[model samples]
Target: MAPQDRLTATFTRADRVAPTPLRSIPQLRVDGLSVSYGPHEVVTNVSFELGRGESLALIGESGSGKSTIARAVLRLLPSGGHATGRVAFDGQEVLGISERGFRPLRGRAIGFVPQDPANSLNPVRTIGAQAQEAAALLDEPDKAIRKQLILETFAQVGLDTPLRVYDSYPHQLSGGMLQRVLIGLAILPRPALLVADEPTSALDVTIQKRILDLLTRLQHDLKISLLLITHDLAIAAERADSLVVLKDGVIQEAGRTASVFSSPASAYAKKLRADVPALNPDRYAALRDTGFRSLKTGQAPKIEVSAVTKTFTVDGKALTAVDDLSFSVPAGTTHALVGESGSGKTTTVRLLLGLEGPDTGSISVAGEQITGRSPEALRTVWRHLQLVYQNPFTSLDPTWTIERLVREPLDRFKIGTRKERDERVREALANVGLGEHLLSRKPGALSGGQRQRVAIARSLVLKPDVIVLDEPTSALDVSVQAGIVEVLLSLQATLGLTYVFVSHDLALVRQLAHTVSVMHRGRIVEHGTVADIFDNPQQPYTRSLLASIPSGGNDVAHMRTRAFG
Candidate 1:
């Protein structure tokens, strides 16, 4: 039979035998699993189980061995990596099997969806070719049947144009679409268990919601067991039936998702809960209400954007990137521009920072007209207006030391003599809570959060009046993001720095932004205070974005209640 029709038969079977009761044989189980690499133990005594058609989350910080355990489960450990203990799928031990014997278990009985789709898919091959190649590994051998299955899976994964997506290369699709394609490829063979590792961490909140909802539906309708590995506590809390909190290669806590969050036993688990923005929704919002760096209303606004329109030539056609955008950021406050990937947030920030002149309208920072300025003139504007890029890993020169990286702006502007510039560099480092010892180290030596902090310190070195932060924390994990946010808040309160923040995460924006503009299709759909925008949004697009926030842990919570009853 064709794979598409085979998938339909599998669904019919699932409908007849779904939601295996509590105490049944688990679909996946790990008992006392310990993994070591070159005599260095990374995962120790980790134990967890996923019930049939259920999801279990493994959550922790980086180097916590979450992925290590996952790799061990799939027998994909890297060089010198050794795993001991039990990994059972469908009550059969998988670890004892040899490589030749294990080959059949993969792609037929088990499927894996890794974190990065860009690396997972072949860049040079058409999506259809790649899907067909993957399909050939299973029982389906007919080319036409494989093509039909691939198209059916693509459409089912919410791709509106399956044929177009099938014909296009991986680069032609957006990150979210690529992720959907990857998921579809994994499930095309009707695997019994799906392992998703950091599946939506890099996506926009709206897209993340869709991907997660799709996963939930796959679990419910297809009755596939799921093992979710993520550092995001909010997603783990809402999506998993059970949670295993890992730290330093050991299981810190494990229990029903709702039970653990309600009264976490481990300090690590509690700290993770405290740091997640969705769980503690109001932590940073109080700062705006407490008169912290209250806006200097009487003073000239820090950023004045008047009817700005930015256009670009894409494929020999005029593309309006930002259309008639107008917003004022009061001095010493944060104004966030939020939208989907193509919604003009980046273009608006580019125009505001004078990186690009507007096609129409004017932009002024601190009352200085920035529109239509020569590059030499904009150099002066750049001194008072700096930018913090999205990914610090790429932004900071890997070859430069942290001190030199932070000191570049000051050196460029010739702000001070050798001694004074050195002193300013120290001050900037101190501002972000980085010690002097890290000065000699390059960005490669630092963690993601530390690198971002160094990035922030660099922007602050010039003591710019306005800073454009473009998705500064999106690249970091949740706790690291929280740490970076704390530093930014402290810096803003102490220095009264004006900020233009850009992000696709409404949850993060709610905590950080004073005023927010919801951008869509290169236009401002709604603009208002964070409170007004969230509580009483006026636009349908704005409401949809707000509604996309992940709160699906309730499904597993409900299952817990049902099982206990």
Candidate 2:
């Protein structure tokens, strides 16, 4: 049978089996759970419970064992990983079950949505093929009926064109679309519990809100218990009924979301709350006031773009990626370009970096014309500008040690003697808050935040006047993001560095940017001071973006005022 037909048959069988109803017992009870790899324990004596139809959030920084606990509950751990704990669902023990015994409950009673859709999806298969295989797990004999159910589920999850989406490959879909596909597949079996692991972490804010809303609606409508794993404190506070904060593999705090946010008992929990950009807007605002030096009245801007436009051709069609874009960054202040995916933010950055020439207009870096410059000339200009990319893991060469990665820029630029180069690397690392002990380590040895610090160190070693940061802290935990932001602010203050910050996160943009430019559909729709844009947005698009930020009605503005007043 074809993939679509096979998928249909699978859902048809799932429909025949009625979903397990909520019982008197807790929906899920995890007691004294411990997960270890060899002799190294990661999750130690973790315990939590969820009542029927309730939602719980597992939150912490990277390697805090949030994902480990989730995987352990699902029996999804890899080889050499051992999980010992009492995990019960609806009064039945889930641990110590044979593979054959666990097979029936894997998808039928429990559903899982992984962190990265790209990682979880089969790159070689079409969307329909994967959906079909997942549905077939239901063991439905009727192919036609299963297909109908799958299509219906797709529509229910907001995929209006089920046929088109089903036929498309994973890469053909947007991150949001791919996320919905995963949700559709997860809910096809009508499982009693749904475990969403960082489901929206990789998406833009607007898409993240939509996905969260979708999950909320599904949980309510289906009466499904949800276990959400995330590093975002705001999301946990807004989405879950209860919150569990973990650090170093141990539970720091767990309680009702409102109660925890209002009066967090643990220092770690309090730190997590304070680190959230949305929760503590004044923290960054204060840094801007106290630390930042004012620009000279008549000084030339560090970077300027005038009437820039860029276009690309796809399948014989010309598509404008950036249109008449113009913005300027002062000598030592941050200018943020905020937009959703496909809003031309990346194209604008490429234009600024001279990675691509504009079809029209001009770009100037450190008051030097760069647009249409020869490679040799631009190479000279590149010494004054550098880019810190979104993902440090991918950007840093894994084969090279930290010392080599930091020194590569100095070596490439041929600046100073060997001793001087080594000193520069050490100075850069210190500026980013990394110690010399990490110098001998590779990218694989560092944490997510540490890897990013190394990336910043490499950029700083060049002593560039302007650093274009592309979503630098988007992948980090709330606390880690706060630390990175502090480092950036400190470096900017002490070194007089200019930054062109590009991000989809409006909250972070509001915190760091002196000037803000809102981009939509390859055009700058709004531009103003951060205060004017955030406090009193003029454009409809800008207002819409601000309104889309997920707030669990926590009165964040009031919280900020009270805390920072």
Candidate 3:
């Protein structure tokens, strides 16, 4: 069937299935929601109705103004962004409401959960204080009542040891834990509406599922309306009741999740879904039988770590980050170090790159034990190993241009002269699907995906024997991720380079890695072929990880329940 006809059919099915809109009442009404930032109109004529306890997903690529429309609903536009549309919540005109009146409606009647928890939370204040503050905002004047409310709220979000977590600061908790705290605070007031913008993007697959399940439970039990803002259509399809596809501030398609996913109505929607990268069966078949076996002949050890371990002392208490972890990457092969946060994945990579010293174990590169080496000794080995970090924003120097950023690594290694380095930088940029025009722009000027490509370009300039990709695609969109993966594959083929990929994204890992290593806490609980790990994982932890991956094949329909008024 034609893409447009299919999308229309899907949307038509949703319209037929959904109950007719009540003339008297709608939980939230956004009519001709237009938003502009100075000279540019970010979102134009956006309209949607969210009934009581209904979920509406706002999905699009980066810079598509999905977030803008979401923020406009709360009148929380970024500085200089103006809105010219009627946003009514619970029959009240929200955009027309006074600041004093809006204050009560914001946290009590409607709650917001931003994308990044680090930015949402206060680093210095304890989580208890934050939770208490959230409860206090509800006008529960009594001290005892507030304390009881906060503790109960924390418990509702599945936070284990509420007392301990309350006492701990934001920095002390992991991303998943912090997200739970955010959920606790948002739901403390029992708000009618909850707007979550990419709430689980920073989390691992397991944590993402836990958060999704928690949100689903909350929506049903509390009868809360949800407006989920995300770039992931898979997440939207798996969680939302209604899906609204947006591109360049325009609505491309809107319908029930199942209808839109099974058969989209718009060309844009079809294109977007087609762009999502699924696991390649042929690649999986090739590596499914290759368990934790030794490398084949003519394979050079581009990156080798022999029994690496790391320990940290916090408040005089010792904690082991990694325990005698050993792995090797042969030339032209990709070795993935799969683990959750704090599993010592980053620490292991740091040691291999001579960025830090391991407490116990030696690291060998090209047959040389480079552990405990001097700065001079490390410099020679550093040229052979390059790293592409997870957060491209923090990795690239904001002050430098893309050209300078890509050229810095070459100059550091003294690979070539100024003109030669420039040529190599240009070549690297092209390899990553960027051009010389982007070279003049600073890291801040580029989009998230573009910034990451710049980081990749910089790493590729060295043409190292091994590249350590630390969650390279975690922060990017699926289409951008697919493009980046292609670039990495091409580089591997052309340069005969090896890769050590560290990521919490199981789907991405399964697509790229030859062998999978499932880590829990600080150790690998399972190491084997991708098929062995996915189809029949031995360890309970491994099985849990496998089960947690959000797939369309999973029984999500049963989990999706709309709350009634």
Candidate 4:
């Protein structure tokens, strides 16, 4: 079946499940919940109640202790972690219970879906085997029946080729596919409460919508309470009934999702709302209005790809990674390439960066051809082009200090002396708003936002004309992403830099890119200005992508009326 057909089939299954009536009694309740890891108290006096068939979202940035609270409920905290609280599920106390006591209630009564599917599943095990284990936890004694039920659940979750997915390992599937598998496993037991922690953070917008929809359908059909932990306020507004805002292990505010979004009671909540790029209409207008001034001056385009085509062999079959792809980025402007995982966005980047040779077509950087350049010849071109990768944690060397990491580019180019290199590193750090104190610290010691800043600094140290940002802010929180976006805008305006931003985040793309290209299956489906693509998308795929975005307009209006009236 085709991708669209698979998606349609999935939607059909999701829509078939009718909403179950909610029960009156509280399904899960936590009172005076306080969790600590050794001497450090992460969660302090957090309290919330989740009624049957209700959805409650815990929203906060990293280190806010939202996830810690989720783990505390399951009694799945690390060895050093301790919990001081009353956790009741269906009128039964869960905290302070023995492992054996909690065993029966875990997968049988409550289900868990973690953030990263990659980290949750055993890479060595087959998907069917892992799912079968989950089925066993539900006390399904008969082997033949359990296997049949597992496959049925997989089909219900919209796995097109259930047998293929069942036999495949974790590493063989995409993030969206893996997430669906995990969701399928979680719902197989038909638990009363489903805890989804950042379940869609790593997925594309369209895939995220499908997953959320599936979860909603499951909740309605199974009459299960949902405890969703996420950093995205938009998702919370769309999918959750109530919102619990946490900061530094403390509850900042608690209320209906719409009410909180419309008029946040806490400063943190308001800040988060302001940070969401989609909510702020005028945030990027000024930046965009700055316009492509360099384009009018008759300057050549900074980066150009003319009919570039790249193919790779996978499973003894030829896969066209990038098929006759063509796009250009003018100087001092941002051009975004938006697509799903296998849409050839990364392949195009690889082609542009000279990491891989295109089978056909030409790529140029600053008017210099780079498609067939030798390594020695391309060394000069490397100075004018740099890439800031997706994950800062994994990209930076753990053993190296911040100074060494940032200076490695300059050292490789043999651009400066020790003093000059130190000055350059300091200057780069300052540009990204990092202080000298972090110079000696390694990437591990820095926070997510700080490490990303370091990565940007490393890329800027070369003072490249074009910086290819590959999902640079996708893994970050909204506020952190806003900060990074602001930094990039500032850098572009001041230094007159060009950016080729590759991302799945349409919201961020709207705020950052002047021009947009929507790729689907190795081809550019749509290309135009940001307004044209977002406000008036011409292609069906682009329109579908836009529709997939969770719009909280209805919730906002409902909140407004409820709060004021």
**Prediction 1 TM-score vs. true:** 0.95
Runs with alpha carbons beyond 4 Å of true place in candidate 1: 1-3, 6-23, 285-293, 296-298, 551-565
lDDT of each: 0.86, 0.87, 0.80, 0.86
What lDDT score is found at residue 432 in candidate 2?
96
For residues 1-565, what per-residue lDDT tens digits would candidate 2 score against the true structure?
7644554454453432335663457878999999999999999999999877778999998899999999999999999999998998767788888878877888878899998999989988999889888778666767666676678789989997998988899999999999999999999887888999999998999899889878987887677889999988888887888999999899999998889878999999889888888777778765675323554353468888999999999999999999998987788889899999999999998889888999999999988999979888888888989999999999999999999999998898899999999999999999999999999999998999999999999999999999999999988887888899999988887888889999999888878878889999999999988888999998888988998776556553334224323
Instruction: Give the per-residue lDDT of model 3 (tens digit) for 49-152.
Output: 88777888999888888889878887788799999989988777889777788887788778988899999999999988777778776565666656766766
Better of 1 and 3 by lDDT: 1
State TM-scores per candidate. Answer: 0.95, 0.93, 0.90, 0.93
Q: How far is candidate 2 from the true structure (C-alpha RMSD, Å)?
A: 4.7
- Compute the lDDT of residue 557 as modeled in candidate 3: 61
Best by TM-score: 1
Clashing residue pairs for model 3: 7-264, 7-265, 8-265
Give, for candidate 4, the lowest lDDT window spanning 10 residues: 10-19
Candidate ranking under lDDT, highest first, comes to: 2, 4, 1, 3
lDDT of 1 by residue, 170-214 (tens): 999999999999999988877888999999989988999889878
